[model samples]
Target: MSDPELATRLGAMIRDVPGYPQPGVVFKDITPLLADHDGFTAVVQALADAGRDDAGRPVVDKVVGMEARGFILAAPVALALGAGFVPVRKAGKLPRETHAVGYALEYGEATLEIHQDAIAPGERVLVVDDVLATGGTLAATRQLVAACGGTVVAAAVLMELAFLPGREAAGDLPLTALLVVDGA
Candidate 1:
């Protein structure tokens, strides 16, 4: 379940930038929401909830965040959950040896990498990202976690483009999205 009040407040903060980075695509810009201290705090709290069990105890051992925007949201989520934070970056971004996985994007293909030692064997993980689009990023992140011998218990995104096939692509992964946008 989602909080209607939070959804209403945060949704208002998201600016619809039409034709951003390309034509016919409306980007859901969240810089305004990120700038609001109260809104940001609320979002982090809500996302952190995914890593907790029904008893309200943190159930994950590590929180894995994808490259770029995911880094911003996942770091604080890890802190709130009292779990370790792991960054799944683009290829060659990390100095240490890493495990990498490639996936197809809407426009092209991309690869994601994670430090081989980031997640210990048998560790439980929670994946966090700013948005769920086609679900390629989330799927790749899950593979990276598996490569590192960790299990992803759940995934949380700030927003979901409901019009896309992201939910189907995600398969059976437990997903929680704060907001769902129906169309462009």
Candidate 2:
């Protein structure tokens, strides 16, 4: 059950900017869609649906949003699913004791951190992000959740760059992407 019109609308709003932050990289900018009331609402609802079961019951105890863009989508999703929101931040951004994981990006290596007490033992987690590219961030986030004794049930993204090997990097973790772009 997918909405064609919504897909069309959302797809149109995503602008492709060539060579952003680095050469040979086309950034999928989602600002236009976020600025629109209806589009934003629809996208949030769509992403939140990933945290539910087939019978429409919320199945996650926490919704984890990665650094920067992920925070924008995951906060509302957490509210929609009636779950707690946890932030997987960049190194040193968090004040308290945290568990850290270093990951390789397309350009360089980076580390992410989460508070030691962010999630109670055995909490179910759903990771949300703006885009799925190399999948390094998602993998590192998964490790962070595991350190907190939480399990990542699935992941949701607004867009997926199919040219990259993100799906493989995710391994067996379920991933739902609203729009799939075949190329960079």
Candidate 3:
């Protein structure tokens, strides 16, 4: 579970669209929460907080965000944490030499890419995303970070689908979500 107050404030704004992109799936849309200035700010700040150490230092050198929606929250989180933002894009979206990882999605397999030089060796990283579903995306991002020699210090997500076993999928990685759905 995430922060109860934060979840209460932001969860209600998430709209439900049944059978979106496929059947039998209830998509949780968060555009409404993003539109609310205060809500958005709170969410971003709370996510950035996850990048800090116990001594209140920004221990992360980079914030890695997955493709598409993940980019939205991650860029802001990187800025808030005083770290650089790196994008794990899909397929050929990147323009330079990159490292790629293929992971299993619920329906099939997909690939994600990151720049080879995105993170230096020994640099600490924080992965951010809007949602944590099956954890395939975050796991792929973690592999990319390892390939780049960067350490994934933690992962921060706006919402988590708890029922989906995403936590188990992420293994030992530290995860902090702002909202959690039991049905997820």
Worst 10 residues of 3 by lDDT: 1-10
Candidate 3 clash pair list: none
Report the CA-based lDDT of candidate 2 relative to the real structure.
0.92
TM-score against truth, every candidate? 0.96, 0.97, 0.96
Tell me the lDDT of model 2 at 21: 74
RMSD of each: 1.3, 1.1, 1.7
Query: Pick by lDDT: which candidate is best?
Result: 2
Cα-based lDDT at residue 12, candidate 1 = 94
RMSD of 1: 1.3
Regions of model 2 farther than 4 Å from truth: 1-3
Model 3 spans with C-alpha error above 4 angstroms = none
TM-score of 1: 0.96
Residue 59 in candidate 3 has what lDDT?
A: 88
The digit string of per-residue lDDT tens for model 2 on 1-184 reads: 3666766887899998988878888888899999999899999999998999999999999999998999999999999999999999999999999999999876679999999999999999999999998889999999999999999999999988888888889999999988888876
Q: How close is candidate 3 to the true structure, as a TM-score?
A: 0.96
Segments in model 1 whose C-alpha atoms lie over 4 Å from true places: none
* lDDT, candidates in the order shown: 0.92, 0.92, 0.90
